[model samples]
Target: MQWIENGDLSFLDNRGMNGFLEYEKAVREIIAKVRVNGDKALLSYTKQFDHVDLETLHADSEHIATAYRDLPGTFIEVIKEAAGNIRSFHEKQKPDSWDVTHADGSRLGQRVTPLDAVGVYVPGGTAAYPSSVLMGAIPALVAGVKRIVLVSPPQKNGEISDGVLAAANEIGIKEIYQVGGAQAIAALAYGTETIKPVDKIVGPGNIYVTAAKKEVFGTVAIDSLAGPSEIVILADDSANPDWLAADLLSQAEHDPLSMAILVTTSKSLGKAVESHIQKQVRSLPRAEIAKKSLDDFGKIILVEDYDDGIKTVNKLAPEHLEIVVTNPEQILPEVRHAGAIFIGAYSSEPVGDYFAGPNHIIPTNRTARYSSPLSVESFVKRSSIIQYSFEAMQNNGRKIAEFARYEGLEAHARAIEKRIQE
Candidate 1:
């Protein structure tokens, strides 16, 4: 891992920080093709990327039922438990439609409505993340979205993961497709012959998936253009070096591009953590990927004081911020930007990612400064409600007309005038 002093080096300025660009262009081309050609384009891309020859892209009820039966009882129980927690957390975030009536008998308020349909994309290359299905689908479910469509790449044998299917079934998601990558995003954004387009798309994916979401954002809503997983640990000398090293490695093992950094005021602590990482990473199966991530994007910045360490963390705006300092709450106020904050030594990033109930689909690559974690709000829309009584319109008609005329909208002013005359 790279070592630097807080005042001398700015960690966020590193050139290796940006998301991979080469894969983005490929995804854009795929999106355009799918948008124009629809199902034909989807079939071609599915064959080329997923290497699955499919008679039909959609997963039928029978397929889903079989998946449910195939999954072990213990895993199914775990999914249900996790889904309950996720649903409970998001249920609190549900917004209500409300109206207020004035003395003049005019009513005005906001109407909260669930999105008609939503498409969730789950990555299928390395492994099946049943937890992701629960995390992504529960929010839409809690918000009362009518239709939930799931899209994931098929395995080499042209089958969807049993766990993915089980989770979808548990959440009452009926429409699922054996599709993945940029093409899956395109199919969801623009309907194919078999698959219907959705109002929004949510979940994490590779660069191709991220770029496809970015391209189709205007046409369809998206959760976020999430990048690789990342974590930043804000620690002091009091933190356990072994725990600190393990936390950093957890994120590092996510992807080759995933970043993990430790910002501390203790040089001795930094050295100890580095030593611990060297010992800990060797036994892991993903050591090569973790090693590359740590070698390139990872760093340990030794600061003169705690304030300096906090300042650097804010600038980096990592996806996951873990405060393992003496008093985690003391530095909590200093953290201005972060997707999620894991306070104290016990609160690890994985806890939030899996069982802690908060959405783990966080903003990455410095996007935490602007974007936020996925929630019930992402699955609903707010429409302004306006009802004006004749008396109320008559009272305010002149002001309304004047405002419309000031904007050079004669028709708008006349419309209000005509209503007032009535």
Candidate 2:
């Protein structure tokens, strides 16, 4: 970690990975091939990219049953518990269709409707996140999406992860496909003989998968063009240096591009945390990856006070923000931007990543300043409900016509005027 005593927050800017556009041409070709050849292309891509020849593109109930039998009892129980927590949290985000009648005798409201179907692209290979399965699927289920499909790359033995299958089974996700990458995205956007098209796609993936989602965006809605994992910790002298080091390393080990930053008022604390990071990282299995991440993107800025620290954080708008101070509540309201806020030392970022009720899928690369974490709202669409009664139309139709005519939309004006009393 590079410690800057002067606190230059200008280095706070992160890399913008716009749905991994660098892979656009290749992703487009993959989509086109899937469109033309369907299941054949999926099989070919799976063999070519995943390095596995799949006999079938489906993970059946037998496969799920095997997953349960193979896994330990403790892991299975944990998955079940985590799924319950996720489901409970998202269920609260469900929006009811509301109606209101005004004095004009006109009904104006909003109707929330869940998408017909959704596809969750779970990344395989180096990143097999069963937690992402719960994070993505449970919200869709809460939104009342009728059909939820799971697509992930099969491993060397032509099977998805036992943990992944277990998570899906816990949530009652029926459609599980042994497909992934740009090809899986193509299969989801455009229907195949075995896998039907979906209304939206969610979950994180590599450059190719993200690029494929970008290309097929209008064809099907996507959660977001999420970038790499990241975290920012704002702490005072009250925070434990050892705990701080562990928290920063947690995100650093995720990817080479992942960032970990700390802003503090105590210069001595910064030095201590930096030392702890070095000591802790040596023992990590992904030490090389974490070392590279910390070497490149890790930072420690010593500010004069929390005000300057928070100002810098607002500009950064990190995916995860941890505020560890004497009184965390006093500092929280100043946080204008962040995907998720972890208040106090005890509130580690990883809690939300797995067992916690909040969704772990967050906006990265400063997007949290504008966007939000995935929720039940992402799975449902809202329609404006407008019903103008005869009396109401007579009273206000002229105003509506005038508003349209102001924009020089003659047809729009005439349409409203057609029902006017005058």
The best candidate in terms of lDDT: 2
- lDDT of candidate 1 over 61-142, digit per residue (tens): 7878998998889988888888888899999999999999999989999999999999999889668887889888999999
TM per prediction: 0.94, 0.96
Model 1 whole-model lDDT (C-alpha atoms): 0.88
Question: lDDT of model 1 at residue 233?
Answer: 93
**Residue-by-residue lDDT tens digits, candidate 2, 225-292:** 88878899999999999999999999999988899998899989999999999999999999999999
Clash count for candidate 2 is 0
Which numbered prediction scores highest in TM-score against the true structure?
A: 2
lDDT of each: 0.88, 0.90
Clash tally, candidates in order: 0, 0
